[model samples]
Target: MTITLVQGLLIALLAMITGLDCWLQAFFIFRPIIVCTLTGLILGDLRLGVIAGGLTELAFAGLTPAGGTQPPNTVLCGIMTVVIAATNNTSPATAIGLSLPFAMLMQYILLFYYSSFSLFMSKFDKYAAEGNAQKFKRLNFVPLIIVTLSFGIFAFLSAYAAQAPMHALVNSMPQWLTHGFELAGGILPAVGFAMLLKVMLKPRYFPYLLLGFVIASMISFSNVLPVALIGGVFAAIEYFRTREVSDLKEQIKDIDNGDDQDGI
Candidate 1:
């Protein structure tokens, strides 16, 4: 499907908004789940967007910026996954692998931005020393604007300007290579989940994890709502149980303090 100019503009607008949000860490609308859904909406393929979003979100679940380290760019991954899938008439899985280069490109762009912006630090200090609050505030927005504009430009180029070439390239790929991409895409989500488990899985939580695995494997449903509901129930139980334990500890401490006062 050909991407109309209006659609391209809308995608660019969305990219700008999410890019700013990512820089500000204000709203997490930059996440793949939100970004992909919005991209799909703009592309007039809500179902495709939703499916791609789910897969992409999982693949990125364990990835986050830490200190100076940046993971693969989530916003580009989300947008291009949907855009490629829609434009090239390909599966979301295949599109995901195809979108990796774009995501990596954005990652490098952001890293360059970060390094380039550091050169302004001395100027920032100078403005602060001179008590120029206005200048300081304005200077802060320079990087933000540059980042936002870059996102819009790149998204427009990839989604619209280069659509024909990308479509041709996708169509020219061998069946085996396309299948390889699909297999890789399918495996990435599990790898992401394993990464998360490595950090978060505790002995006490193992039973719940095992239970979830068993339920998911043994049962078949039209959708995942039932599994989500069950997980919610387990989460609630854990929350209340932890609260009760905390309350008991507080009560015991209070009683001990009272007994010590009486003895004194």
Candidate 2:
């Protein structure tokens, strides 16, 4: 399934927008799930796109940067995953492993982008010192444009040129290795979940966490949306219950204060 020039350009445009959205708009189009779905749409395979996006999204969910470090590039990873799956007619799960290298590569690209853009800091300082708001704004916008084009060009070329070689490589791999990749892809998301739990679990939230696990285990995977809705309902209940309890405690404290004043 070869993508035409037009389709390739569209994919590039999506990449640019998603990359820019990460910092500029902060609208989260760079997220794996959304970007993958958009890529799938461009490739004329929405179902596969969603599946790839969702799996990758889970794998990437807990990978947000901390301490000034960037995480793997989900925008590039997601697009490549869907592209690989669509091109090779492989399972979306398998595409996860296939796209991993590209994700890491994009991560390095992002680091380089930051380092290169950092050179403009002196120019920005100069503009600021001179009170040249126009040059300052131009300096800022220049990096953004370059970053967008970098993302666009990388995604476009990867999607356009990598498909044939990638499919060939997968086909030539040993059966064991192929299976290993599939297995790795399937379990990758669990790592993200474990990371999330490590960060978020607390003694007070244990019950809710266990309940969520129980519900997930009992439900069919296809029914996750409904299960998520049920969880949302319970979460709302818990929130309101906690709020009311806090309010009641505050009222009791107020009453006690009133009694003290009367006694005085």
Candidate 3:
């Protein structure tokens, strides 16, 4: 399919938006529902966008950025999956099957960005020490936007260019190998998930993640209402308990001041 420059650029811009969505999604920066819905709208297929976003949402539902680790790149997974499926050619089932591998490939890319972010943080703090606030702030957005936009633009063009290569790669691939990759792709997330779980888990909190998975799987509601509410209640309780502890310290300080005043 020959795409005119304007058409190509539009496709790419839309892809760029999806890439931004991915970066944002790494932190759940924006809700997956909104981001995926927007991408689907740009693609002129809201149904696929929402559907892709919803499933992608569930896939990473248990993950978050707590002490630094974030979920795998579900934003890219949803965008690429939806775009490929929305193509007049591919069926939704095929698109989802394809998305499984693409999402895993994206996980490596996530690690790369994460390492790069660590480096950028060092540079950013150096700028802050020098009192170059503007430079430090610019450093924050520029690299993020660059990496993100590139991911989208490259994926967009590559989807077109790689069709032939991907076909050849798949054809030359042994039946067993392809099956193995597909099988490994599913198995691999549990590894990243386990790593994430290792860091983020508290015995009390871990069960909620499991509950979210269970609820999402069993219910067809638009969102994980029941289980998410459970998480929310727990989080709120945790918050007030922390605040209560903090309040005690302040009260102790006030009492000390009063006692000192009386002595004076």
Candidate 4:
């Protein structure tokens, strides 16, 4: 579980890239699924990374930031989960619970950054008023640099400098405590999915949800690909049906307008 300096640097570089993407809300490679997989690749354990990524992704699926509110940092959750699991030879589930504190630390750091960066708003406004686009653009990079550097430093520390302590801590945990974490980790995805459904589920989509549930329960497969494929087909059908209904409505509206014009 010795993380060499080169590996640590590579991970830090990955963190910086993903951190920038997260800030920009650009390509969402910052998601746990992608982050974890890449981290696993760097650590020479792609399978572990894929497994952990899938679990971690589900756990984080509903924890997206809303407006000014920040959820636990997804990037740290993903990286630390794989790192801890691989380093300690622990289960991914256990690593997930252990990684929570790191995630929260990043969450708080981001909140602090958000507040501190607000102080620059006046400067931005001043630049805008004076029509100094060059200064404004240069100033914009200040926050981005700070955010990415923080990510790199913290990621390097967590994955390399702190690896020994993290490994020791996982080893010292009581069996019951470890089991508890595993249980919680398994349940978290369901809870996250429920939270998502609470926000997104509508009457029109209820049937599809029910259908998916039934199909999933009735078919015991090695993987979810078959179920996903079936769901995709249904989704396509729904899309086309909805489009047809919309077209029909538009046509009726046009016909009514024409009749009214003729009568006039």
lDDT of each: 0.89, 0.84, 0.62, 0.89
Per-candidate TM equals: 0.81, 0.80, 0.59, 0.85
Record all residue pairs in model 2 with backbone atoms less than 3 Å apart, i.e. clashing. none
> What is the Å distance of residue 223 in model 3 from its true position?
4.7
lDDT of 2 at 149: 90
TM-score of 4: 0.85
For candidate 1, give the lDDT of residue 97.
Answer: 92
Candidate 3 per-residue lDDT over residues 1-264, each given as its tens digit? 233355446656655666675566554434445555766776667887787666555555555555366555555555555665554334443444466566556667767777777877778779989999889878889866876677666656545544555555545766666566445444544655776778868997777788778878887887547777877888899999999999999888779788656644
Candidate with more favorable, higher TM-score: 1 or 4: 4
Residue 189 CA displacement from its true place in model 4, Å: 1.0
TM-score of 2: 0.80
User: Which pairs clash in model 1?
Assistant: none
**Model 2, range 1-264, lDDT digits (tens) per residue?**
878788889999999999899756578889999999999999998998898888889788677764355777888889999998888877777888888898888899888877788788899899999999988887788888888898899898888877778879877888788788889987887766666677778898888778877888987686568667877998899999999999999889889788756644
lDDT by residue for model 4 (1-264), tens: 778899999999999999888778799999999999999999999999999999899888777775335878889999999999998888999889889899999989999998899999999999999999999999999999999999999999999899888878889999999999988888877766676687779998898888888988998997778888998999899899999999999889889788656644
